[model samples]
Target: MARPSEGAARGKPRKIVLVTGGGGGIGRAAAQALGTGGRHVVITDIDASAACETRRLVTASGGTADIVEANLEIAEETANVVEHAAAKGMLAGVVHCAAVFPQRTFARATITDFDQVMGLNFRAAFLLAKAAVPVMEVKGGALVLLTSGAVRLEGADTPFQRPFALYGASKAALDRWALGVAPELRDRGIALHTLTPGAFVETPGTRRIDRRAIPSLPIVPARQVGEAIAWLARNPRMSLAGRRLDATAFGHTWGPG
Candidate 1:
């Protein structure tokens, strides 16, 4: 398979990869990793300052990046981010990491809370895919949806406890949706897959939650998840479509040097 950067070597424009939630956490890490690997990374986040910081980090490390500030909960805004990336260069990959995890127990959660979580976490992925697939179809690419282990674990057993109910539901919905939609995208030469960190990651978002509720599982570094995403983006193959991959497993096996 031809890597994303090989185009640049062949005198073609550098391919672009879109990373949502790029202000921090796994999103920031993925942006840095992909950019360092020679892909022009387009980072979208609600926070302009934080996204700019990510852009700085990418450029400082001899990579290229652009920031598109967006509130992904809005369907139009979500699609607009993809449009912005496609305008930059060949839209080669997307890492959907934008999500909200409000620490509200199910009993105390309101319809508004549900809407907010599901809107950004689930709906944004749908909207981005709708907009990006056609642009990417001209040249095959990859779409990686970041999922959580909370989707499988019981809410009470999760690190976030009862508050994880809505978050888990949102991820479960995304996982099922991605699985159902992957086959058709694969036929279109677009590889779609869901990825998990495979363990708790102490990101800025997770830091806000109660640490006492967390279990004894090993903490996976954000960079591991980032590298796995970059790996998937660089190798968008038909054989890899529709699968659920673990970042830790990839890190141990075929990770970046």
Candidate 2:
């Protein structure tokens, strides 16, 4: 684990925040924002090159970061990531943004596809929270699980057009699981919550989707979501635990304001 030069010399250990899928999109943005806020960010992603680029961006902004390359879909690897973050310094929070949004309708989707989406999207979160809660209990920490609007079934009657069967199922399962387990984690001084972007944001994954199929909804900047993640990490109040929070609805200023 590499320590910040200034903090190392002064014997001041910086708090660590672990970010999954830190290679690009919201993950990279969160790393940049958290790092700039003076937290030592430990970024894990399957793509070593992309994760390295995120580290460079963090460093350029005068923040410290370390990269770990691992596939979160693998149970062992997910647990190992938490262990690695704990070794760095005081582990403060975890931002889980690694997920696959494959556009597959039920008729076209196979069991293999189901496993792949659920494995990374939901199971990895379970494994991470199980591994991190113990380490965070020493003081306290936060876990922010990225959720999606696809989970709502009110207006999603036409699944064939949207093709979010697998993606929506995975996110819905994650939301229920987090809601069920959050209070228990809260008792242990660990705040667990689900967070949503509140609007569509262009990312490497979403860019693959056909634009015509997507509804004409408001688009949110990725940096705004990053700011929300940083805010949740810095302030893990019990009142906020077990809640599903929307980044845009909070009306909080971005960064140190």
Q: Against the true structure, what is each candidate's TM-score?
A: 0.93, 0.92
lDDT of 2 at 82: 95
Total clashing pairs for each candidate: 0, 0
lDDT, residue 143, model 1? 96
Model 1 vs. true fold: TM = 0.93
Against the true structure, whose lDDT is highest? 1
Kindly list the per-residue Cα lDDT of model 1 for residues 5-49, writing each as its tens digit.
547778887799999999999999999899888898999999999
Model 2 C-alpha lDDT per residue in residues 89-113, reported as the tens digit of each score: 8888999999998887778899999
With a 3 Å backbone cut-off (N, CA, C), the pairs that clash in candidate 2 are none
Cα RMSD (Å) per model?
A: 3.2, 2.7
